[model samples]
Target: MQQPGYFAEDVLPLLASLPTWPQPSRKGATRDAEWILWVKMRMWNRLKAQFTGIIESDFKEQGLEEEDLAWIAGGLVDAGSATSTANFHNIVLYLAACPDVQATAAKEIAAVVGDDRAPAMSDVSPLPYVWACIEVLHRNTMPPWAIRHFTDADVTHKGFVSPKCPAVVCDTVALQFDEERYPDSFAFRPERYLGHTEFAGDYAAMADAQPRDHWTFGAGWRVCPGTRPAKSNLALMLANILWAFEIRPPTGAEKGGKGSAIDLSDDAFDMYPLRQARPFKAGFCLRLMLQEGLTVEAAF
Candidate 1:
């Protein structure tokens, strides 16, 4: 599905029109460019504020404390260092956009964990269903590439050989969507991991058969140190979203008939030629149960 808008539509055209050479002579042009960049920055900040407000509002309505809300937001913010904050923010924004996952997670948490107290990290862990949902989101929506590595010495993998300085890349999308690893690879079936019989005897062997294959957080020494903390934050946010709402396709949208069907062909971009695009849409409504018995709504 091609997103109707093109990359050059909004700001790119203006950026492309600017002078690129003889910089010292283009003082006025430089000032204009700087001003435009500042405006773009402000626009981004406003978007962030709006989403942050939504999350905060949800927390408040659940009778959570201001401090707890701040902690949750801060944990997400601090998961990546300053340089990676924007990437982390983008990930959170994508998660927020997925209404079905959010509603399911919130419902599960509310039923299993309850509203008498806020969820602790430990409380969030045993909910394998929630974690599996998070895994799917991460696998499906993660950036298409990680930083490329140049092998410093001869490297052998299986029978293949590569010399030093060969460019090595990680094709995350392919790894995540491999059909052999994930039978019915595109379906969103949380129960796939629910019971012992479903996975057979060896847990490790069963895990190997799924595209929960590689580390979405990269691998070895350079694996994202932030992976654990990031997952924790995601688990919490997802739990909250699930506990608070119900997700469904927008009215009049087509639904797969009776049996399981998944549309995995959603258009996406690769590392190079990156462009802005419209994402698939699903809508959500807050569950009334959350609102019925709540206290200290103002603090959150």
Candidate 2:
């Protein structure tokens, strides 16, 4: 299936003219512009059809206004895409750091997807470990704060009264690693969210109310609506990448692997200005044969 995009080449610039939207200068858009631009055109057409009519508001018949259109464009371009992109970066870093996990996922992809075609949504049902890696990535690298939420009514929970009309911040790090819920919260364990069959459909239910898998996408009514899409994108992306190439740390004259070149320094996780992940380096060499890699399918 084709992915969605923000908007048209010209219409996007017009929408982005809003004060809130950042007008990023177009520089070197041609490094790989041919296919990239074509893909974007298709995506833009897909999204354009959805915005022609009144956008579905939070109930109540509020017609789509100019401001609403701007908000929609902003939400599509930044709010949703940024976090998912960040998650992708974090997942890549995790796989580069942990070769064993990457190898396991690669094995799974080879078995289920084979070498003929790339991974797809249908292949997701059997690729639990790959999905588990995504879960682990979410748990390990969560946004410091989820989208700020406001309480609608005076509610009390665990002995505190959150009065109505007050902004609330979910301490995701604390909630995710609470000693009660997760025994070894600090450790990276994808298996924590695994064991359930058809995890693609099951994991989201676990995240609602009280998060079971991870807290990267937040929770409750205001939770990220792109949660499922983000996961699906992450899974398919990882599968496709692993299927085509064997990613490893840059090697040098020192003989063996020099370990992951990924730097998780202050600059690395400096998730400000749209939570953009700083660039990092990793080795990607095309694997000659994809199906040749298999390790006696161990049912975990």
Candidate 3:
């Protein structure tokens, strides 16, 4: 069924703007803009209506209010869509920038999932190299900071005192790039994660003694609920994309002879509350031609 697809365009910017603390003066303006967008776009209203219908038909006994249901559903949609899109964009950019890495992932996907159909969830377990690539890319491209968390009661760690009720942001980039944990720290090498089969969420859950894979998903009770699904979907997407096409940066001539060349460096990213790769040219060459109307299930 057709559904609203404008959350990225309408709601994400509002959400992102709400947390920006670059200047204390802009806080009021940001909230005003959010309210204006909420009224003008009515994206949340549309979602609320859709959810209301579902609850009326199937969950009337739960006594759930439409506003509560809408907020719950909207939270999931907003949380998943923006982050996932940014992540997928970052993956494509990384693949385009590093052809060798892409080639390695493609080979792994090819060995695990033949050209019969698109990749499926079942193929994820056998594709460790591809997962490594994703892990490395995520480490490099995740948002510099995580969602702001509050201090619960007065807390002291590392000899710093944080008063309760103040917003505390987890510095994700700093943790991920710690030289002690990630040797060389700045290089994009999937080899670091190779043979490491645990997902980020798994590592987040381990005891303090157990070395975690990455902090991209945060930790503790506030860890991203979509961690496992996001990883599976990413692996599936990487596999399918590698199976279907070869990704490359634009040609020198197309890039205006280095004057405006695609930037594979960290400078190409916009590090706000979310990490988003700026627009860059990339070429995708089709590597496989599937039968018309073919589905992943058809391969079985």
Give the clash count for each candidate: 4, 0, 0
- In model 1, which range of ten residues has the least summed lDDT? 196-205
- Tens-place lDDT per residue, model 2, 101-191, is 7788899899998989988888986899888877766664445565567888999889999899887876777877788888877555677
Off by over 4 Å in 2: 1-49, 53-64, 140-142, 196-211, 254-268, 273-277, 289-300
1 against 3, candidate with superior TM-score = 3
The digit string of per-residue lDDT tens for model 1 on 1-300 reads 112223332324455555666333245556776775565455445555665656745766888764554445444444354324333333333434454655556667877788666667777766777776655555543445654578889988899899999777777667767787768876665445444222111222333534233445664444555565665666676666556555433333254422112223444323322211234333344566535532111100
In order, the Cα lDDT scores of the candidates are 0.51, 0.63, 0.71
Once fitted onto the true fold, the runs of candidate 1 whose alpha carbons sit more than 4 angstroms away are 1-107, 193-213, 252-264, 268-282, 289-300
What lDDT, from 0 to 1, does candidate 2 have?
A: 0.63
TM-score of 3: 0.73
Superior candidate under TM-score, 1 versus 2: 2
Order of all candidates by TM-score, from best down to worst? 3, 2, 1
Per-model TM-score versus the true fold: 0.52, 0.68, 0.73
Tell me how far the alpha carbon of residue 257 in candidate 1 is from the true structure, in angstroms, after superposition. 20
Off by over 4 Å in 3: 1-69, 156-161, 252-262, 289-300
Best by lDDT: 3
